[model samples]
Target: MNEVAVVKNQILDVEISDLINNGMGLVKINGYPIFVKNALPEEKVQIKITEVKKTYALAEVLVIYQTNPYRVTPKCKIYDQCGGCNLQHLSYKYQLMMKTNFVKEALVRIGKLDVKVNDCIGMQDCWKYRNKTQVPFGVRNNKVIAGFYKENTHEIINMDTCEIQDALADEIVNYMKFLAQKYSIPIYNETEHKGNLRHIIIRKAHVTKEYMVTLVTKEDKLKNENKIIDDLVNKFPQIKSIVQNINPQKTNTILGDKQKVLYGDEYIIDYIGDVKFAISSKSFYQVNPIQTKVLYDQVLKYAELTGNETVIDAYCGIGTIGLYLAQKAKAIYGVEIVSDAIKDAKLNAKLNNFNNAHYEVGKAEDIIKKWQKENIKADLIIVDPPRKGCDSSLLDTIKTMKIPHMIYVSCDPATLARDLNILSDTFNIIEVQPVDMFPHTSHVETVVLMSRK
Candidate 1:
């Protein structure tokens, strides 16, 4: 084993060599790796060791003698306190570069694939692009405070606005906080597991300019529901849905199984290109609608559908991607584990007036095999899975099916690499395109086109 050169709480000066996936700077002391927060590559900084593990030590910047050229002042006042946007200090150009590099490095190091990654596609106007905002409500010093949670803790960093969230949504969040105070609504305490209101979630449809507010509470009953609805609707004439979600459990999950419509409709309408989606409080629509179209357009370009090919959409939530491509394909079959999402998918298909779209509720791994047994083949398969990536059984099923063309949409590069490595035996990667779906953050979205060998 290598000798340790740093001790906990020890202050030392080091030159940063590179940045890790989470935007932390990495430095080496006697060939031992140390991670320093807020330190940039090629920079010299004084840091105090906060933690020392077997192979690595964690540190925080004390003073920076040299800084990277791309570093900039963070826009958010609580950029260091709030954990929402980590790369705000990095210039937008460098943020795109870092995300592209993240995908390329993950492919080579984790997936062991020799593939070229394209530069990340960025938005012209990245701020105020998020269509959804979920903020937890807490009472600090007998006053209601709402915003993002502080880093590494449940403490709330109260803010009136966020750089990435929609401006109107931020306004609605502040209004809700005001109403909570006016009505004396008890804020849920995670420790004591008491109180009434827990979180305030706001959603906006960029295309339709409609809004939805969902109040997550520890109980079904709400204080001054009528006045709250009347005041919010009167204040924001764009609001189309006012909802209350009952989350009686003492857990950390935000939404509950039961939801009630306090006023207006239960859902709001949104559009990506020509395809429309009905977004409920529980729907899994992308937060950034403008970039969602860009990502989907990339998928469409890769698919090159001829309007006569069967397309299988796996892990299809609300039929967003599949429905986007439905008009170009002969038929679309979508499978999801959530029955509600499948129902929404079917509803969205109807909303789009696409008769060729079919949806079923089941695991993708199991459904694909069932389709194979029924001799229902797909000319193209698209999988947009969670961060954990595709199930091993699903990958094996894809291998057995040997679909001619496939597209992998991933939010996590590491998992995308692992799955691509497994599929490499049967598919040849044509290209990879990363989209800046969430700006000023370490997260990235990638689309890969693969052809069966």
Candidate 2:
């Protein structure tokens, strides 16, 4: 083991060797690595040690002796303080390359699989692509402000516009802040657990141009609720739905179980390709609908539907993917744990007039077993688990079922590799496609196709 050489506040000039998944630069001193922020690979930088640990240390870039050619000024003014976009300084071209490498590295290092990873599919226009914006409300200088929280802290960054979010969303957030101040809406304090409003969420449908606003609060009673709702509707006629989600608990979760539709319908409509969906306050739809089509197109291509195969969609949120593939398949059975999502999924299926799609609300692993007992045979199975990846039991069930073909969609590369390693014994890796769902951020979405050998 190497002895600790770097101390707190120690300054040193180092050459960055590589970039980690979080876009942090790797600097080695005496065989020990230090992670530096705002530093790029192949650049010489002077850094100050922020924190030191046994194996690794954390650093902040003090001065760049030599900067990378791809580095550019961040577009957002609050990019340094706000923690939303991590790769704004890096060029979008290199950002795609880095995300491709992120997926390739995970497959080789974590999954122990030597496979070829295709280049990441990116958007032509990445800015202002996000359809949903959720900003926390806080009291700054005795006035209400709304924006994203600082990195690893609860303090909100007061900003009127975000480059990545829809322009209309920015206008709505600023106006809502003004309305909150006028109405004297109380801002919730995590420490004291007082006040009424906690956060404001706005979701816009890119295809339909329809919008939905959800206010998260500590209580149901709001000051001048009718006036505020009326003012918002009149100000933004595109806003078809306004909802209030009540979360009286003192926790970090954003939305509560109980909700009330303040004005208009409870759900708004959105489309992915030809499939239409009714998105509610809690439904888990993809933020980037443009790249989502590209991603699902890859899934459909890999599935190679011939109108004879029965498909199963595990972790299907609102039956988006299954419904997207429902046209060419014999039947589609989708399972999700969220009851609200299941309700939306059923509603979306009906909206699209697809009677072949079936949705169930339960743990996918348990539901798969029940389906297996009922002699429900599926030709293909698709699992799009969360960042934590699929459950071990669910993987075991998939292996046991011996599904001929499988498609695994993942948002986290590390977890995707772990789950793929478990399924490698029974499935042969066919192809891995990386999609740049969230630009100017470290997150990447991947879709992998596997076949029974």
Candidate 3:
């Protein structure tokens, strides 16, 4: 990577490749794809090349002397540092437009499908939409450090307050510092591989207005466990649940092992629409509640399941969407790969008292095949896969089964486009709706409704 002086370089006018999704502008400078971060299309500005390679150059916004009308001041101080939200600097309406174009670009470039995507479904409040946040702790400057790292770097930027997360979440960080100082629990160190605190994942229930604080660290790290849990429960009665996770490994992953409940309920319960779900620390619940409600409603509306139609919810975690629509359908079968998630889903079904909804613990594709062998037929199927999106085998199974109505919820549009290209022969895309699940970032969640001809 060579250092190129972009500001004073006497180069010709560089034409942007338009918004190539992810809120980045592409330009083939020197026959290489130069990715300019925080850049807008059709807008010319001098950029500072941070890293110049033979193929592409990574740059930062140096002199946007000419600003686009869509650009707005970033509300969060950690806008450029924390990778949590990228589009916050841009206006809400502009954010909506950028996301709308993102989906359109994916369809045109990746899927090669001439599909008409509607305007992105915007949220009521983009900030403070997150109901949960997992703040990581790493050692830096010779002590415990708490904050998010710079984008694409291991360096952590200490933040006094995070605008994207709820104000209570910010307070929790400060409160934990007081307790950590009082209890003398050392924070985790990535370089030296020594420290006590690893992560603090705070879960908030919207309806209940209760909070669940789960402290994750080594099993034997907490010296005075009972006293601390008692102190937390007593001090913060609103803290409905407290959990201690034992994870001794060295990884940046989320889940932990051997959770020991210190106080309050075992799991936190929350509602989405009309259905209630049991949420564990490891459960993959939607981070944004406002947009998730819209996402699920769109799923049900697209399904159009009659009271007599049977619905199958593949990859249903905790049965949030499936259980809500269970009563409308004749029978709802929810399949999940994680057994713990399946257990919680079953409990949620029991909690909702919906005898029509059933949950099975197995891979989405594997369980669907097994159910096919058991002579199971579904009139409607809804799949909300992880970020990597659904695989070919799953799409192939859907095509072979020929499900009449299919609603696919995807967080990654590139993979969604790839899968849609594969399923285009049998199904005509009726409509595609982009949901603003994550408002600040370039990432957008899309729901594609397809009906078989």
Candidate 4:
């Protein structure tokens, strides 16, 4: 430990010892932990303390005296300023290693379970894997700006291309910005609570090569809408759906309740492992279709369906995982809180002719408790909860039902470990698999298999 006094706005030299869960580099100055962004482990750097706290201090790296061997040059020019991807500076191989360790560490430290965690499933070509793009529209220096938000700020970093998103989506966004400028469209200002255009969201299907363009605006109407639509349709022949989402509120939420089809259909079609799905403007589809298949396939393998088992897919969004498993299971009951998602799930089930599959719109925990009282039983349960992980009530319901097996899909490793700890008494951890759903980000998705003890 160095004898330097730790104070706010003080510049000090430090050695990065480790990386935290959010991809920030960790260094200690005078026996106090300091977190520095854009720094790497095993590197000596000079940092300026931005804030001083009792537990830990936050700092920004000023200079690197020694660099890590695994550090690489990020492809995106705005990678340092954009909040999209954090691990873009780290080598791809090291990113995979860190993610694999993330799962193992969570299981050991939080779950208190010493289990085998397999190496993370990585992409062959990590760039341009995202199938969706949501670019915020704004104005800077009297010019239309559209791109991602700056790190920890609402300011947009105007970008013509993004290494992670599909190239066509970037092109569409640039074109939208160009048209907004050409028509002199007013850009929404959050502070003033005025203007019309807000965001431009683009979605693409890999197998079908179809595209959906959704223009999110502050009002229900758009200026020069017909011309913009005609231009977009003529330029992109693959565009299947063009829609407008009206978000009149002054809040930060992107999509509003009302959506209108400006041209073409209201929804686009896509497939995931032979299961066709109709994706609407508000549908919750995985951004990475390639890794989603890998994640879901692991879920199916862990499910071990025998053609006679009844399974409950909790928090089933659009019935993607449930419909995939419906091929081998006797029956599938999917539960979701979103009514629109439930409707889409039912439509997908009907389209696929999976009469044995059923979907209900309700809180997953409440529905599970109701089913328990009604004497309905499930041989296995698959839960793909949000980053917060499974609710306590749902975990209790799972314990009460004593399902023979469970497949837990989690985006946040810490939450997954916490939930696994809560159910450790009832279930035994069999194995864990970490999937690199977002290649250049600190986030890692994991799938766990647990069997009744």
Candidate 2 error regions (>4 Å): 1-3
TM-score of each: 0.98, 0.98, 0.93, 0.97
Please state the error at residue 26 of candidate 3 in Å: 2.5
Residue ranges of candidate 3 with Cα displaced over 4 Å: 1-17, 139-144
Q: Clashing pairs in model 3?
A: 87-440, 186-196
Count of clashes, each model: 0, 0, 2, 0
| List of clashing residue pairs for candidate 4 | none
Across 1-453, the per-residue lDDT of candidate 1 in tens digits comes to 667879999999889998888879999888889998888899989999999999888999999998899999999989999989888989999999999999999999999998999999999998988998999999888889999889889989999989999888898899988999999988899999999999988899989999999999999899888999999999999999999999999897899999999989987999999998999999888999999999999999999999999999999998999999999999999999999999899999999999999998999999998998988889999999999999999999998896899999999999999999999999999999999999988899999999999
TM-score-best of 2 and 3:
2
Off by over 4 Å in 4: 1-5
lDDT of 2: 0.93
Q: After superposition, how far is residue 312 of candidate 4 from its true place, in Å?
A: 0.6
Best by TM-score: 1
Which residue pairs clash within candidate 2?
Answer: none
Task: Write the residue-wise lDDT of candidate 4 on 111-216 in tens digits.
Answer: 8988899999999999999999998899989999999889889888999999999999899999989999999889999889899999999999877889999999
Task: Quote the lDDT for 312 in model 4.
Answer: 96
lDDT values, one for every candidate: 0.93, 0.93, 0.79, 0.92
Q: What TM-score, to 2 decimals, does candidate 4 have?
A: 0.97
